[model samples]
Target: MKVRALAGVALLTTMTLTGSPATAGAPTTAAPAHPTAPQQATGLRAVADRAGLRIGTAVDMNALADDAPYRAAVAREFSTVTAENVMKWESTEPQRGVHDWAAADRLIDFARANRQKVRGHTLVWHNQNPAWVNERDLTPAQLRAVLRQHIIDEVTHFKGRVWHWDVVNEVFNDDGTWRDTIWLRNLGQGYVADAFRWAHQADPQAKLFLNDYNNEGVSAKSDAYYALVKQLKAAGVPVHGYGVQGHLAVQYGVPGDTLTNLRRFERLGLQTAFTEVDVRMPLPADPIKVQAQAQGFTALLQACLLADRCVSYTLWGFTDRYSWVPGVFDGEGSATPLDENLTPKPAYAALRDTLAIAAR
Candidate 1:
């Protein structure tokens, strides 16, 4: 997924908490420290266990495999896990009719070992699709058939294991227009409905969601989703959830109407989630920037907690060690709660404080 700042956004951007002692390869100038060991009573998962919500983070499979501290933090902090990339179409099916489930299976197994639920990210999206699924090469009928099969097969393979499937992702652009991707160009907007139905058929027990960024607050994009959800409901489509990819930046500030937006969706009989959350700032961090970042992280979380049926709050990645932000957005990093050395930041503290209060 590409990272681009929202247009006409001011660059600027919360929480309190303690930190664990820095480990090997720690940055020379560390973030202000918090007492993480004493705060173990309020580990994100521990507090979230009582808050009636699942706290999750996207897992970088390689880090889970090779980085001990990273692996440990993932298991300790989150109640659920989302694959950062491995479960996407390109990674899962590199070639036509050839599927690779090893990496995804490993994540599922890890989640099970830790008694965490797996959130199956993205059965359908414009990005990270396999190279073979060419727009110019396949006709609409052929494309539709392939997409249906992919959803069914992928969902079926993980049926009882996955708690939620982002069945269709980023189908609409920031302005509420259908993104001119292969699915929309070929199968039309009905592809969203078809993807959800196919996923439901494959895993009747799994919750299905439509996910997108820049739609966190009520706007043209969310309005479009509201209308689509209504239409799908009227037509008896099996869409179950609306996902707000809470990918905020300090410069953009947090959306003020997030709760209002979420409430409207809940009233429509759908669950809501703050998926893919991370608040990045301009590099060379300072006190003000980090403080704003914490607020950005907590604002979305507060909306989820306040909403009647917002089921989960998931960090795009829990630690900066494997963050996709720096690479994608030059001069911007430290998007996750933990820093690169796996030390907790103020953002981590803020989340802990928020969840701790909810737990109480």
Candidate 2:
């Protein structure tokens, strides 16, 4: 998830913080009444399978071991998995040259055991860097060497296990300017292309993606990605996909041009995905808010279904019990398909209905 300073007010402020699902609140005037019975709880993976796409969720290592029900739900509902944090630079290599694969390896093993594919969370990001990456004060050439080695070693370790790698994450500011992260400060914009290239060299079969939030619709941020992707494609950078982190808030309503935005990326011959979908609502979620959240989730799924090149829909997390929203944002949460008790919510049913229609 991309963590940035909160901006705007009401809807926009909520949107800036990141993503999740909803609960059973009062129905808004536009929303359909909550279904008394949410179908047969047909797993999302089954519905997605019928539509020729994958439904996935981010997983934490501790959840796999400590929460039997959560693990069961993951295997039962999702066809793909992404490590929430274990694959990031800070988690994988906390110290110089000392790689830690224990947590990440467990996720890959679990995915394989359940006949699911793994999407490596990230290979390069502006956040979650180990202290040494910046504290060492390395020269441009030295920093570039460090980045190349990190991508190569990490991608090589996973090899055939991962189906997709988020080669570069959240590289552009909301205004479309390149973010001045350590990578940009040290190696400039070329680092983005180099990161994708090195990852491809390490894992030829793995699909590479540039992942970010607030790019679910046509905007300055997404426009920046479009230009960069065009350049990368012309140069044969091996970028196979573009990720739209669908971290929405009901207060703002869904982005009207989400499908249009995704289709544009498809025209560039890149696969698009709702990489981190979660429709959060303000605290004390009323029925109106829940209904809106359900509508938001349905719209997003419909958008993905409409886009031929959109290959997957992945939630940041599935259940509200372990959601990352409340910890990060005050007076906001309940952004997942399942409530704290692991029962399917209105959003889950909305997703099912959308997938069912698409499957037909």
Candidate 3:
């Protein structure tokens, strides 16, 4: 019995170290499979199936069209997909009244082919509004009409295709106050409920969500959402989900109370999702940072797993090759489960192992 136990311990250690650091931009060989980590061969979507969780990743349209490997990885790895930019207001309607659904349509079709559900990113956001939408030229009444029309038209176009619509995005600040935007400046706080109503009217079946970052834990931001959900539910608003953008940095440790925060919203009769998760670290990554990043990714996944109503956990992007972090954040990058060469990092192993254990 002692010898058998020692053999099992040796096997576990080998599997754990299999995904350890390799030379930058070079593919690291996949770890040898074991009973607990089946995802190396089965892919995340397969393991996630047993657990009834929607494993997803944000899809970059340009990369999807241009890179064969990227396209394959997206189809094989995720059971749900969100357009990284194509579904946003500016991309969908760059020129006033001239909507371009080519890119967005292609994405939807891809998701359909892969049997993946689509998450319509946002119907309303202060940033990424088209050039024609503004307070400088249009009156408040005109702005309100335009906002309503935008929500209705967009939702109507994608009606049955979208699984969830982020009806409003980043409407609150860190301190739990409303952020100033064209919608707020012209329409007032009631615009939120109005947006939800407009979306529900267009697609009564699609779930509507309020999405934001920095609300993974019970902070002032989440408190504002909690209050808003209660008010919306009280008034019979169509809000159905709470979206936590799980963007974590190694410098700032993962929140310990994420599961607690998720449960509070779940109790309100709303499905919850980690909509945009990625764990970034400083450049010139080392073994310590790699391990820490894995923990950060699994931390969010574990919370979603434990919460009864947490339906999905989606990565912002799954590969460092096309990650948005380095372009946006000056000094930090490597914010994905896979390296630039499409090698699975330790984070990938961690997520797979967590899902495997949960399945059992």
lDDT of 2 by residue, 174-210 (tens): 8899998888888889999999989999999999999
* Estimated TM-score for each candidate: 0.89, 0.89, 0.89
Off by over 4 Å in 3: 1-41
lDDT, ranked from best to worst:
3, 1, 2
Candidate 2 accuracy as TM-score: 0.89
lDDT of 3 by residue, 174-251 (tens): 889999988888899999999999999999999999998888888888999999999999999989999998888887
TM-score of 3: 0.89
Give the clashing pairs for model 2.
20-278, 20-279, 20-335, 20-336, 21-335, 21-336, 25-287, 26-287
lDDT of 1 at 105: 84
Each candidate's number of clashing pairs is: 9, 8, 0
RMSD of each: 8.7, 9.4, 8.7
Error of 3 at 2 (Å): 35
The pairs that clash in candidate 1 are 11-251, 12-250, 12-251, 13-292, 14-291, 14-295, 18-34, 18-35, 19-34
Please provide the root mean square deviation of candidate 1 (C-alpha atoms, Å).
8.7
Error of 3 at 100 (Å): 0.7
lDDT (Cα, tens digit) per residue for candidate 1, span 1-360: 111122222212121111111111111111111111221456898888877789999877777777666777777788899988788888778898998888888888888778789999889988778888986788889999999989988998998999999998887767788889888888888889889889999999999998888887778889999999999999999999999888777876777788888999999999999888888888889999999888888888877877788999998888888888877777988888988898899999988877766665
